[model samples]
Target chain A: MAVNKRETIAKNIARYFHDGDFVNLGVGIPTLSANYIPEGTEIILHAESGFAGQDGAITPPWDVNDREACDRELNNPKWADKENGWKIGHKDICDASGNLAILSKGASCFDSVVSFMMARGGHLDATVLGGLQVDEEGNLANWMVPGKNIPGMGGAMDLVSGAKKVIVAMEHNAKDGAPKVLKKCVFPLTAINCVSVLVTDICIIEFIDGKMTVVAMAPGMTKEELQKRTEATIHFADKIDVMDIVEE
Target chain B: MNKVVDIRTAIDKIKSGDKVAVGGFGNVGGPMNLLYELEKHPEINHLTTISEDFQMSETPYNQGFTGLLLNGQIDEIVVSFFGHKKAQAKVDAGEVKLTLIPQGTLAERLRAAGAGLGGFYTPTGVGTVVEEGKETKVINGKKYLLELPLKANVALVKAYKADRMGNAVFAYTAQNFNTAMATAADIVILECEKLVENGEIVPDQVQLPGVFVDYVVHCEEVHY
Candidate 1:
């Protein structure tokens, strides 16, 4: 059976994380890895937007009453509720600015700190981020597309370079059937020589000894087909196995 | 001096062709009330905005600078992440210019300006496009790029609470770029959800001192 590319990539990437790992999941496919974390392993997930230590997924039962109460306080200065009433057992739900508001429905509670300190201090054990293209030398070019009006390079550069290990989770090929795993990245690079592993829809490629080597492939996807899709030279591992992706 | 003012008066501090630094990561902690007020003043054009993230999340919370960008108020943006499709369309259409900086470097630059430093050296973007025209120095067998401090004519910040004296406290992740932007601008405007009397907040609770604040406005709702 053919496996979903995003699920396969996310599942394979989750295997690299261990217990007590300070993992940063970038937006997109990497964020999906949270759903595939093994049952017993404890991973402290950090979001650069300012929350850390949340469980895999941000489930809901969010404190709606607390949000309304905070909203009331905002308009009425005479409302003397100094303390934010939105408390889910020591967890405070505030508006995005941290004001006492209804807890955001899909978010989990986390410790707050200066996000830059976490990024620059190199506190992350691993970062799973998406990539537009990853070169043979492990350089990442996920921020910009050449000649295209690219939005600003968000936290990808910091996360890619600051994390102890960088795992790129992306589709094996672009929508037009071009290889994203390339010999040389044609797009503007986010960071140089930073990517450690590549988890794509079709195969798991690792940059080892300065070469792009295929360590595993998706079920029924042959090495020959992966080679045809790739633009760079490829090598295969001796004990390649079908990727195991847990279904939700 | 007490710096608290209404949003209309706060918008008056911004002029045409001004460089403004805003605090927030996406919609979180953004000075939405101030930006909305500024948006109404169409004469305030050619604004060069400095921020961490430029794109809105396509949610209702997407109200701040994205609104300004959509209205064609922003001329250029110096940001770390520019992923909003709506804003990207503007850039693609040549309505806006973009300069991308590494996220860590952008934060440190703002911090350096607030701290009164000339410039600092960082290892980020040493050999990439970020290093193209910047000065580079090798110290201790390591390459570092000399990044200048980024200051602004006006800064709009979002805080959870503020005392009448303008001292502010930030909530959770909403404090992203606010504390740094607060001190790096000539005129600092704070949008707070709650206002307290002077001396009500403990010194330790103050994330930004009143000395850096020039204006404070009570903002009941800021989209995040």
Candidate 2:
């Protein structure tokens, strides 16, 4: 069986995150990769809420309250002493992680100007976001749907502009079975020319020379097959690679 | 000390056809006084607003001011870009014109305008799709990209606290581009929630001094 879109996108994001990199995760499916950074990989997860090194999965429990925290910090030997650094609350950890941005000489609350400045100032190394659509130019349009009324645009815009490397992780198609990788987005924009890589369920796409270059694929999905489902032209790489591991 | 009512009236003085630059990154914090007063000016039109991202979905940015974007206004917008769905609709409807800029370039242009620079060349957009129909200059045997300065007639800034002198501070995440915007605008109007006494605000705590601020409207009716 072919690897699922979720696994494919998960692994694609793993490529950018090696070790000792400051990374920020968005709210949607991009949040799924919290525990999938691979074994022996050193990555510091930065939660905007203030967590610097918190780690955990969104507790999925069918028996109890299924909705749980998306973060967890295990008592790993390398992270902290077994007695010193135990399993900590991700929310508490993120909230404790304050940056130099917060120690500004003046201004108290979070303003748009300072917020965007931190983002635009390259505070975070990598930002993994979700998108409804990504074009050949690697432009992402995940904020809205054309006709469907929805919620307000979230931190996607800030994440895109400020993060050093922008990685989008999403499914291959829409709920109605429409291709999300399109020629152009039909909804309002969040940010323009900010997307760096398109990590989708079916394939891994990146903007090389202002065009989408397919560098990897789902286990069994070929470039031609991935293109068949996507409405936009598929710019395939000369060779496609296999995904590394499953999302833990 | 003007009451909340007078502050709202002061905001009402903002007429239509005003060029404004709002200080807010996404939407967490904004000048509620200005936004509220803008609601009264339904007669306002052809407004050019410069903002970071999601801060402009409200009334003044919604209807009163003409968007200088690829989607909002009839004229033109110089911004990093409108992302996702909104960009598509604006492009499809052919309602507005858009000039997209790289995030760094846009921030720098705004910063350059604030710093009183004519223009700067960066190798960022060079040799990529971002380089199209732009003047290319060779400097020191290398190609550099060029973008113009982003100046505004008026800049609207949001802050957490302020002194009677009109100095303001920004909240976290919301302080994206306020200072650069404050310098670029001809008249920088600050919308502050907390206004303390002149000496109440410490000199060290002031981010933008009252010298750059033209008007100070308190946050009387702003939603938290």
Candidate 3:
């Protein structure tokens, strides 16, 4: 059976989180990293939308579509009949992507001003975000495409600039098969020299001593295969290891 | 003094081309009733709208900036995130001038305006388009971009509860930009789900003081 690439990458990224780390997970593949956090290793999740310590997300059909189907599966009929749909949590409690969130035990919420203060004030231990392009200089371009797709930057700029460690979790290449780890980013940059680590489906690269260093590769993947998929110039560490893909 | 007023009276204070700062992370603390009232007054056109994000929904009941955008009222918008597909189309078509800022900078700009600061320096947008045409300074050997303060003519904020005196208590994450926006605007109008007597709310628990709030209006509870 083929490896679940997304889960594999997420699991590898989760290994970076230490116990009691205050972490922010960007939308898309980065959000999946939360589910792969090793057991007994707790981390506080921060959402720039104004909250921290989110434990998990509610299962979708965020809105109740088929009443009969909802009634058959859900243990609580009341949750299935709510106006916002069969949500395990409150409608107002959501991540930046508007997915209903199930907060952790000690979850606390605040306004955006203070929420961003925690981000810009250098309180976050780490933040994992998606990337459109990452350059050899550790520059990341994930916010906008200019004249094409301009979904605003949100808290990405602040997160990358302020977090103690910045991790980029993304696929190795663009959907069109172009290498995303580029020699230079053509798109608008989110931040400069901010990415500390990059985790892709096939490899894990970290910026160390001002160089893009490949420290790990997916099992059965050769350096040449990864080099072909990456556009940025990278150096392999003397002892490269297979990335741990097991969930536990 | 009592600050409670009817919704119409509160919204009527807005001018034709005033800059309006709305408080919300999407619609969490959005002043939907106030924005809906503003939308009904098509006379108030060519306004500059500011918010964290403009969330678009097909649901008619959702009183987000989508109505103002569709009504062709907003001439410009400054936001951190805008996922409204139709609004983006309008932006690409050269209808609305969109200025995107980093989220932390957006919040700090509003705070700086409220705090009466000239501007602040930060490293958020050093090598991006945000640094273009902006002052750059090297502090302690690291480059920082100078960001100016952002103030507005009026601010519309929402709260879970408020006293007639305008002291407010926000519920959950609904306090997103409301607190900062209240202090940054010339006129601050707040809509509340519940209204209480001046002495009912404990002073220590007040998230926003009455001094920053100009008017208070009771609105139907915002569902989600």
- Ordered by DockQ, highest first, the candidates read 3, 1, 2
- i-RMS of candidate 2: 8.7
Q: What is the TM-score of chain B alone in each candidate?
A: 0.95, 0.79, 0.97
Q: Which predicted model would earn the best lDDT?
A: 3
* Per-residue error (Å), model 3, residue B149: 0.8
Model 2 spans > 4 angstroms off = A1-3, A24-31, A38-248, B1-5, B12-15, B54-102, B123-130, B138-143
lDDT of 1 by residue, A1-248 (tens): 44577877888898889998988777677877878789898887776666665535432233433646445544442322335332221113232222233232233432122565666567888988889998888888887777776666666666775678889988888899988888999888888888888998788888888788788887778877989999888888888867876444
* TM-score of candidate 2's A chain against the true A chain: 0.75
lDDT of 3 by residue, B1-224 (tens): 89999999999989988999999887678888889889888888899998998866655546588788889999999999887779988898999999998998999999999999999998888898889999999999989999999999999999999998899998767788899888899999999999999899999999999999999999988665
User: How well does candidate 2 match the true structure, expressed as C-alpha RMSD?
Assistant: 8.9
lDDT of 2 by residue, A40-150 (tens): 887766544323444444332121111131212222333334444433221112211111111111112332334445554587888888887776656667766766643
Per-residue lDDT of model 3, residues A1-248, tens digit only: 66777888888999899999999999888888888888899888998878887764423444533335434444454444445342334545567776555555567888777888888778999999999899999999998777776778998998898899999998888889999999999988999999999999889999999899999998889989889888888999999989976433
DockQ of each: 0.39, 0.09, 0.65
Query: Using Cα atoms with residue i matched to residue i, what is each candidate's TM-score against the true structure?
Result: 0.83, 0.61, 0.93
Candidate 3, lDDT over the whole model: 0.85
